[model samples]
Target: MFDQLIAYLDSVRARDPAPRSRWEILLYPGVWALGFHRLAHWLFDGELYFLARFVNHLSRWLTAIDIHPGAKIGRNLFIDHGFTVIGETAEIGDNVTIYQCVTLGGTNPTNGVGGKRHPTLKDNVIIGSGAQIIGPIVVGERARVGANAVVTDDVPEGATMIGLKARSTLVPAETWLREFIPYGTPCDEPCEQGNGGVERVEALERELAELRAEVAALKEERQVPARSRKTGAAS
Candidate 1:
């Protein structure tokens, strides 16, 4: 029992809002996170929905962290510093990484008595900053949600999503950073479309390839042409 407490404390210190020494993290984070989750879970289980919401709201206001009471989060889930939110009825697997301003909410703003309403995040999922994952969708294991992405559909295992509307990108699963707290970076070459440079690059490559083929055909035509022998003139 004592050993578990010590370990939980260590994890908290390491992943809490404040950056502390190794020893400080080893002792603080566990206690804070545990306390927060316990209250949240307790309120969720209770029938007092209004009071539960009120408590959750107060907690978020005071801590800049908001988790709906009905959300089911597994053990050792680290909440890194930033604006964090969890939707009611959201089911999170163990060992998830959530950065600031991330939402795990349902699309239905009005409450319903349905089971498949909120997002279900599988184990080891990494959610980036300012990302909005709304609706009833499942984010598969080890899936990575990129910064400022608005996701509404289901994500497959090891998938990486990016952009406003949220499209899967070529970023590999291994390269995903667990704690991705994004800040605004000026775009050196923002695309005409919202997909940064991906769409533009593809278009340019296609055009260049066509141009090269056309040039080669023109050169071949200029070089050697069949002349009609009967015409007695270069055709």
Candidate 2:
């Protein structure tokens, strides 16, 4: 048990540079929240729903992180900072790193039956702060969700999702091969190819310029005809 704890702390240390020691990592709200969740999950599995909810509520009160007792979390799942919520039926695989203010939220069922409503995150996935991964989507292994992204679809393996209504970024080969990227966003210039918003803006600017030129030509033609008519009238 102590060995497992050490390993978990080491995993968090690898992802976060702020922690000075294992002791400091131990004091993190995320760590305490995970501990409470384990007990709550056990109770939930044993059909003690009330007790599981009780533990879950207590954990939320103490840590400011809400994790449903029915959520299945795998080993070394790290939640950096707090204000994160994992919904019921959400499945998180090993070494998944979730940042602050992220939600593993669910969609409302159409048939009034609650099945797998929440998302399933595969191993080594990283979710950036304020990311909303909604519905029964499967975020594939090594997938990265950028900060403030709203993902409603299944993410492919090693894909980096960014922007509102999240679209997949074109990750360079070098960036894709990297083991870790802070906040799931690549800092390199090559990764800018995925910025479709910039391209769209440039296209709009070109169209506006063309429209202005056409308007100027039409005005010049009309002015020439008016000048010719005035000269004929004067003659």
Per-candidate clashes come to 8, 0
- Candidate 2 clash pair list: none
| Predicted structure 1, TM vs. truth | 0.64
Best by TM-score: 2
lDDT of each: 0.70, 0.95
Off by over 4 Å in 2: 189-235
Candidate 1 residues 80-173, lDDT tens each?
6647777778899876777777888777546666666789999877787888899889999878788788899999987788887998875533
Q: Give me the overall lDDT of model 2.
A: 0.95
TM-scores of the models, in the given order? Answer: 0.64, 0.80
Give a tens-digit lDDT track for model 2, residues 112-151. 9999999999999999999999999999999999999999
RMSD of 2: 6.2
Residue 194 of model 1, lDDT score: 71
